[model samples]
Target: MARLALSAIVMMMAFIAFTEGLRGVGPKKCCFKFNDKPVLENKVVSYSRTSQRCSNPAILLNTVAGRQMCVRPSASWVKDLVTYLETKNVAGANSNL
Candidate 1:
């Protein structure tokens, strides 16, 4: 009886560990959206096309305050925002030169 109880406890522990491991295996879903929001403009410090952390193709924005936000790359507004930032950066550089 003691041996049966020990085997059952071990099986339960193994099952729990397996379930936890399964839960941790996938990337968590993100619900970020840029719709109806004002342009961040100069607030964006940097942007990236490729994201190693996100499961989907996301435009990752690093804000001036060091906060990170993920936006959908396929969104037209996101593309326009990136273009605006690039143009602003170029104009700023030209003024300095």
Candidate 2:
């Protein structure tokens, strides 16, 4: 009886590990290098923050040309871009009202 219970527990642990691995539970997008050049605000379609699991936090910019660029979040250009995007979003939302 003891051996049977131990086997079942081991199997359950293995299954859990297998499922997590298949699901890709870790960060898929991480930024190691940052683009120093400032992108035109109009060219950027959207932006997202890198996963917290990443060693370096960065801003991910999605451009109109469907390119992704990583930039330091603390950079002045990044701050300006985020502010511009936020204002643009607000204006767009207000226009729909």
Candidate 3:
């Protein structure tokens, strides 16, 4: 349970880093790295909380935890990103999700 909760937090932070870009400082050219052999099987990329930050959307969709996290973006920042992304796709950026 603790692991899951921690994972969730990590995922959310990662989402914010990419989707919102760290306090409007702008995107940081990020990417998600994972080891899926246990469940994702796509561990080519490498990124841990301690690793450098990134802002690439491809990173989020490439893994299980990442995919879930990408579904969420900071509420305050989504409007701008969505506008930039040019889509009304706030399907997962909500707190309810």
Candidate 4:
């Protein structure tokens, strides 16, 4: 009985350790570079910002063509695109009601 309990405890600890390591899912995705060329707002399917933990914050745009582009958050085009997407999402959601 003592040996069985000890083995169970060790197995539980090992399982916990393994799960904790995988909790992050994978490495933190950080954008090291950015695209300068502007993309058409119509081509963008969605947009998101990089993690705050990232050293260089950026805007991530997912295009309809299945390509992801990283752009500087401070860019004028990026700002406009974000605004357009926000309003578009709001309108789309309202229509579903």
Clash totals, every prediction: 0, 0, 7, 0
lDDT of candidate 3 over 1-97, digit per residue (tens): 9999999999999998787655676453444543222223342122222213454333232343444223223333433433433332343355347
Better of 1 and 2 by TM-score: 2
For each candidate in the order shown, give its overall lDDT on alpha carbons. Answer: 0.74, 0.94, 0.41, 0.91
Model 3 misplacement above 4 A: 22-97
Highest TM-score scorer: 2
Q: What tens-digit string does per-residue lDDT give for candidate 2 at 1-97?
A: 9999999999999999999888787788999999999999999999999999999999899999999999999999899999999899999999999
Clashing pairs in 4: none
TM-score of each: 0.51, 0.77, 0.22, 0.76
Over 13-85, each residue of candidate 4 has an lDDT whose tens digit, in order, gives 9999999989796436779989999999889999988888888889889999999989998999899999999
Report clash pairs, candidate 1: none
Q: Against the correct fold, how does model 3 do in TM-score? A: 0.22
Instruction: Give the TM-score (vs. native) of candidate 1.
Output: 0.51
Any runs in candidate 1 off by more than 4 Å, and if so which? 1-39, 51-55
- Total clashing pairs in model 2: 0
Candidate with maximal lDDT: 2
